[model samples]
Target: MAKNPDIKAIITTDKDLVINSGVPVFLSKNLEHLQVLCESLERILDASSHEINDETVIIVAR
Candidate 1:
């Protein structure tokens, strides 16, 4: 993904989750639905107490 001046970085995952840093961004181009995708991930994360990745932060851009 191309870098943006306002964003520090853009990350693409195998599951089609695009995460952006510095500025929050979620680019779910291939996901079935944005809400479903986020809810699914949220369930997975809620199952755990500890942080999965210190560097990874989930943010919703409205």
Candidate 2:
């Protein structure tokens, strides 16, 4: 997916789902531009809460 210009982001999780592995794992890719993507996502989550509304939806795709 990284090879595709149209693919902006990609999310993945471990089999146990005990942790958000993507947050740290992707940082290791060492691409400055891609590193920002992970940082941005972490910021968004840190700035928001789990109190979602009825109209809100979250999807985690492998």
Candidate 1 regions off by >4 Å?
Answer: 1-26, 30-32, 47-62
Question: How many pairs of residues in model 1 come into backbone collision?
Answer: 0
RMSD of each: 12.4, 12.6
**CA lDDT of each prediction against the hidden true structure:** 0.37, 0.34
Q: lDDT value for candidate 2?
A: 0.34
Worst 10 residues of 2 by lDDT: 48-57
Identify the leading candidate in terms of lDDT. Answer: 1
Report the C-alpha lDDT of model 1 over 10-60, residue by residue, as the tens digit.
222233444333443445444344444456555643421222243233432
Q: Candidate 1's error at 36, in angstroms?
A: 1.4
Per model, state how many residue pairs clash.
0, 0
